[model samples]
Structures are given as C-alpha cells and as structure tokens.
Target: MDQGTQLLLILVVLLVLFLLAVIVFVLFSVFMKRKNSLLREQIETEKRYERAIAETQIEIREETLRNISWELHDNIGQLLTLAKIKAQNIEGGEEMIEVAETIGTGLNELRALSKSINPEAINGQSLIYSLEQEVNRFNRLKYLSADYELLGDAVTIDSKVEIVLFRIVQEFMANTMKHSRASKLEVKVQFKADALEITALDDGVGFDSENLFEKGIGLSNIDKRAELIGADAKISSIPGAGTQLKLIYPLE
Candidate 1:
C-alpha cells in the first residue's frame, strides 16, 4: 500500500467510528427523554387523583353532617319529647320508670353519634380512636359484632390523610353491616416507622374480589380514596370465607 492510500483509509475509518458514536448518543438521549416524560405524566396523574379524592371527601363529610342533624331531630328529638310527656303525666310509677329508661337510651345514642358528626373531631383524634368509635357504634346499634385493635406505637399522620383513611374504613364497615350478613367484624391497625397498615375482616358471605369493580360503586370508591392519599389497598374474598381489606399508607 502507498502512503497516501494508507492515510486516506485511516481517515475513512476514523470518520465511520465518529458517526457510530454520534448515532448511539442520539438514541440514548431520545430514550432518556421519553422515559422522563412518562415519569412526569405519571406524577401529574397522581396529583389529579389526590385532588379528586379530597374534593369527594369534603362532599361526603358535609352530607354526613346533614344526616346527623336529621337523626338528632327526628330520632333522638322524638324520644326526648316522649320522655317529657311521660314525665308530665303523674300516672304510675312503672310509667315513670319506662320514661327514665327511654331517656337513658336516647342519651347513650346521642353520645355515640356525637363523635362521628364532626370532621374536625375525627381529624383531631388518632386513627385508632376513630376506628374504635366506629366499632362501638356498630355494636351499640345491634348492626354487628365489631372490634378494633391497635398495634405498635402510634405515629402522628397528616389530618387530611387521617380523614380519608377513616372514611375508607367507614365505607367498609357500612358494607359489612348492610350486605355482608356477617355476625362478626374485626379491624386491626398496625403502625410502622415508615408506614401504617389497616386490616379489616368480616365473617360474611363473600363475593369475588376479581370482579369488585363490577360489584358496587362503594367498593370502587374505597379503593380510589385510599390511592388518593398515596396508599395501597388490597381487597380479597372467597365464596364463604368472608371479605378482607388491607390498606397501607406510607409516612413522609
């Protein structure tokens, strides 16, 4: 080979290697850009979900307060009115005793319902306390046998998160009472350093978890509300083994 021919071949080889290196860099840059865009899109979607959940929570709380007001007026108020009439009637000692019992029962009902009427009260309290109140209400109302347990040291969580969590559990309890036909229900709350786990189990006639979305709007809402607060929800049920729901919320 001549000197000029050897130099020309060397330059061509160098040019080819430079072109390949440029192609590889461009491909890598494009891939990274696409990946970053996808990640940003995911974050935005989650933010939207959280906002929707918050709005829904507010609406639900308002409706709940309204219902509580009606119950106080229509149910407990009527009981008090009857008791007063019985008190005014100087008929018999047995009649007076019945009126006293009625008054006592109404007072008990009011105390149980009072804790659930205020969103601020729920936010100010620990999640475990809120769950215990719910369980007590179920038992008091003769809806079902409900119990709650708290494990590990309690961690202070965001109030907004607590409200959402409480609402989610409330929905589950309502379902158990109305549809589960189950006699007993249990709720367990576990607090860890990085996360909080809530588990609810009911010994009721269970349905297919795989088709939950098709089952009822309440179930879907329960899952979505948990996700709004950056929590993971898992629901499982067999034909007769009863339904179990687990939610895990990570701490900041």
Candidate 2:
C-alpha cells in the first residue's frame, strides 16, 4: 500500500473506534437511568399498596364494631331492662332490690359500650371528644381508672389522621387493661402551632422497652401506623416504674 493510502486508512479506523466507544457509553448511561427509574416506581407502588391495605383493615374493623354495638344495645340491653323492672316489682325483699340495682348498672354499662362501639362516635366527632368518651367509659365500667387532658388550642386535623391516632390509643388502652394490671391510665394531648403530641402512660407492670419491637406485632403495628401519618412514636418502659408511649405528629 502507498504511504498516503495507509495513513488515510489508519485515520478512518481510529474514527470508527471512537464512534463505537461513544455509542457504548451512551447506551450504558441510558440503561442505568432506566434501571433507577424502575426501582423508584416499584418502591412507590409498594407503598401505595401497603397504605390501601391498612385503610381497608381499619374500615372493616370499624364496621364489625358497629354491628356488635347495635346488638348489645337493642337485644341484651332490653333483656336487662326487663329483668330490672321485674325485680323492682318484687316487694318485701331487700335481695330483690339489690338485684334490680345490679341489673340497672349492667344496663348502663351496655349502653355505654354501644355508644363507644359505634363508628360514628369517632368519625362524627373530634378526636378530643372521642377520647373523652372513651376515658369516661373506662372509668364507668371500673375496668381501669383512666383520665384525659388536653393542652393548647386544638387545630383541625385530617379525618384519616384522626382515625389512625384513635386506633393507636385504643391499642395502648387494650394492652394496659389486658396485661398491665394497672389501676390508673392517663392520656395527655398537646397541640402546638405546627404539631401535636400525645402521651399515654399507665402505672402498671412494665416490661423491657429495649426489645419492644421484637416483642410482638402489636408494638410494631404502632410504629407502622405512626409512620403512615408521618409521625414519630417513642415507647419506653421500666420494669417497676411503668410503660409510656408518646407520639408526635407534624401538622404541616
């Protein structure tokens, strides 16, 4: 080959190799970008699915509670009323009078349970009002001495957030009643300009707080629900002191 021809061929080969390298680099960048986008989309889809499931579960549970409340009010409550009336009619017997009073008390408790179980009690009213009713019912039933206090001016809260918070409080109360063997439970709520804080404390037998997440699903559930609402949950306990759960939710 002639020197000029050889030089020209070399130049052409170098140009071709450079074009190939550029094409491969561009393709790799595109592939990486696509992979990252897909990953983000998948993560979002999973989050949405989890949120939907949580909402559905709450709805079903509330519906079932409503049904039970109705049955307690209309059926068992009536039967107790009838028994009390019959007991009242029995004269010259102190035992009969006591029986009537007992029946009446039972009737009163049923009515309260009915009101609490109805989903409307929480949905139709504010969170503060709902918590007040729950605390009153607990005291009336003598299940446990429960108290609620509110601080600061309350701000309007989203309904979804209210429901989730109410459920979380209920879970804590249930745990206390069933296992804590505590005589008193107190709940405090503080409203700030841009956030809200809730603290639930029970003077009961407390467990190890360090392993709370590993203990059971109930504790983990509290964490999950709090996260869904962009809140932070802190649970602490002392073996002899007590168990306390605090949740802080940003309003904005």
Candidate 3:
C-alpha cells in the first residue's frame, strides 16, 4: 500500500477507537445514574413504610387508651358512684359516712384519670395543659410528689407530635411509679427557637443504663417512637441515684 493510504487508514482506526471509548463512557455514566436513582428510591420507600407503620401503631394505641378511659369514666365510675350514694343513704352510721367520703375521693381521682387518658382531651389541649392535668392528678392521688414545669413561651405544636410526646412521658412516669419507687417526679418542657426539649426525672432507685435493653424498661420503644417523630432521646441512670430522660424535637 502507498504511505499516504497507510497513514489515512491508521488515522481512521484511531478515530473509531476514540468513538468507541466515548460510547462506553457515556453508557457507564447513564447506568450509574439509573442505579443510584433506584437505590435512593428504595431507601425512601423503606423510610416511608416504616413511618406509616409507626403512625398506625400510634393510632391503635391511642384508640385503646381512649377505650380504657371511657370504661373508667362510664363503667367503673358509675359503680363507684352508686356505692357512694348507697353509703350516703345509710341511716346515721358514722362508718358509712366515712366510707361515703372515701368513695367520693376515689370518684374524683377516677375522673381525673379518665381525662388524662382520654385521647380527645390530649389532642385538643396544649401540651402544657395536658401535662399540668397529669401532674395535678399524680399529686392529688399522692402517687408521688410529681411536678411539671414549662420554660419559655409556649408555641403551637402539631397534635400528632403532642400525643407521641405525651405518651412517652406517661410511659416514663408509669415506669417510675411502678419500678423506680421514686419519691419525686419532675417533668419540664422548654420551647426554643429551633427545638422543643423535654426532661423527666425521678428521684428513685436507678439502674445501670448501659444494660437498658436487658432491663426491658421500654427504652428502645421510647427511642424508636422518638425517632419516628424526628426527635432525639437520651436516658441516663445511676444505680441508687435516679433516672432521667431528655428528648429534643426540632420545630419547623
């Protein structure tokens, strides 16, 4: 072959090779982009599924609580009322009068409990108000010296978040009452510019926080619920000292 023709052939082969290289690079880029999109979508779908499940669980729990509150207010409450009425009617018996008064006190506590457990009440009122009712009930019943405080100006909160937060606090308080054998319980809510912070502390005998899962104190459940609502939860305890739970939730 002539030198000119040979040179032209070499240049054409080089150009073809370059074109093939460009095609491969473009194809790889497209594939990678598609793969990344799918991966992101899968992650998002999983997150959404988890959130839906959490919400459903919350709804079911609230419904159950409401039912219990209704039963307390209607059934057991009626029975107590009837007993008190019968006691009051008993003729000139000092013991019967004392029994009547005791029954009245029991009725009062039951009413307060029903209100506190009622989902409708919690959903309708501010977090501070709900917390106040809970604290007042605890004090009235002498469940322990319990107190609730609010710091900073109150801001409007979503009802869903309110219910979840309230449930978390209720769970902690119940645990404290049942297991902590604490003499005092304090709960505080602080509204900040960017976040809402909640603290619940009990002066009860504490346990090893490092073995929280082993203790089965519902800490994991609390953490999971907090995560679903975009909140951070921190719990600490020192044996023979006390246990404290702090939760921070970002505000939009």
Candidate 4:
C-alpha cells in the first residue's frame, strides 16, 4: 500500500477505538445510575414495610393489654378478693387460720399484679391520669425510682392519648427494670403552645439504639404511636450511659 493509504487506515482504526472507549464509558455510567436508583427504591420500600409491621404490632399490643387488664379484673382480681373475704370470715380452727394466711399471701401478689395490669385504681385513675399520675405509677413500681417534673399547667389529655402514653412509658420502664437494671428513672412533660413534649431518662445499662430500631418492639411502638399522633419520637442510648425517649405531640 502507499504511505498515504497506510496513514488513512491508521486514522480509521484510531477513530473506531475512540468510539469503542466512549461507548464503554457511557454504558458504565448508565449502569451505575440504575444501580443507585434501585438501591434508593429498596431503602424506601424497606421503610414502608417496617412502618406497616410496626402498626400491626401496635394493634396487637392494644388487644393483648386490654385482655390482660380484663382478665385481672374479672377473674384474678375478683377471685383473690373473694378468697380473702372468705378467709377472714372463717370460724375458729387451725385450718381456717392457715387458709387465712394463704389468702393473705395470695392477695398481696394479686394486688401487685393488678396494679401493673390495671393501675387505674392504685393510680386513682387511668395509668396516665395526668403527667403527674404517670410519674407516680413509675415511682410506685418496684426497683424503679422515677423523679418527674412537669413544667407547665396541668392539661387534660384524651383517654386514648393517656392510654398509649401510659403504655409506652410502662414498656420503657419494664425494659429498664428487666434489662437495663436501672435504679433511677426521670420523666418530664412540657406542654408547648402547639405541642406536648415528654422525655424519659434512665440511669441504667443502655444498648445500641440503631440495632433496637429494628428489633425493639417497645421502641417501635413508641415510634408508631408518635406517628399516629402527628408527633415525633426520638430515642438515644448507649451501652453504659443509659437511654432517653423523647415524645412530642400536638396540643389541639
């Protein structure tokens, strides 16, 4: 071939190579873009699924807690109280004295269980009568010392809100007693103009909150309740410094 022909052939080959490189680069960019989009969509979908599951769990809790309360009231509570009355009425006999002692022990346990299940009585109202009432229930609980401060006028909260808040606080306090092994529980409620804020702080063993976000049923319900109430929930905890649960809700 002539030299000019050779040069033209080389130029054609170089153009084809350049085009091939650009094609590969464009394909790579498009692939990366698609991959990122897919990842984002997956994350969003996971969040939606988590929220749905949390709602279902909340419903289940409501049912279970209600049943427990009724069972304690109708069956366990009434039975124990009746037995105590019968024991006190027994005529002179060693057997009657032993029966009375048994009744006394049983009554004490029943009282404790009933308080935990349906504290509305010992609490003088529903577990969440006011912010103060909730704090009192917490203080009365064994192995948990709660010091609560209400920094605003006592506002009347709806019964539904009172129940949910009561349960949420109850669950957190239970966790503290069972797992956290904490001694001091601090609760605070502030009624803002447009919102109500509640905080529960414990000096106990905390855990990785990120991990709890996935498996902690109590925390999940707290979050779900906050969402249902058009509010916001936040929890922060480390392994040693203890945990804090913050709930904010609207006033009206």
Q: Write the per-residue lDDT of candidate 2 for residues 1-252, one digit (tens) a residue.
A: 999999999999999999999999999999999999999999999999988887787778779988998899999999999999989998948999889999999999888878866787668888888788888878887878898999999999988788778878878887888878889999999998888999999999888888777765266578877877778888888877878999899988
What TM-score quantifies how close candidate 1 is to the native fold? Answer: 0.70
Per-model TM-score on C-alpha atoms: 0.70, 0.80, 0.91, 0.59
lDDT of 3 by residue, 65-96 (tens): 99999999999999999999999998867888
Query: Tens digits of per-residue lDDT for model 1 on 64-84?
Result: 875785677677767776776
Q: Pick the candidate with the highest lDDT.
A: 3
Clashing pairs in 3: none
Ranking by lDDT: 3, 2, 1, 4
lDDT of 2 at 178: 83
In model 3, which range of ten residues has the least summed lDDT?
216-225
Overall lDDT per candidate, in order of appearance: 0.82, 0.86, 0.90, 0.73
Instruction: Give Cα distance to truth, residue 21, candidate 3, Å.
Output: 1.6
What is every candidate's alpha-carbon RMSD to the true fold? 4.4, 3.4, 2.0, 8.9
lDDT of 1: 0.82
List clashing residue pairs in candidate 1: none
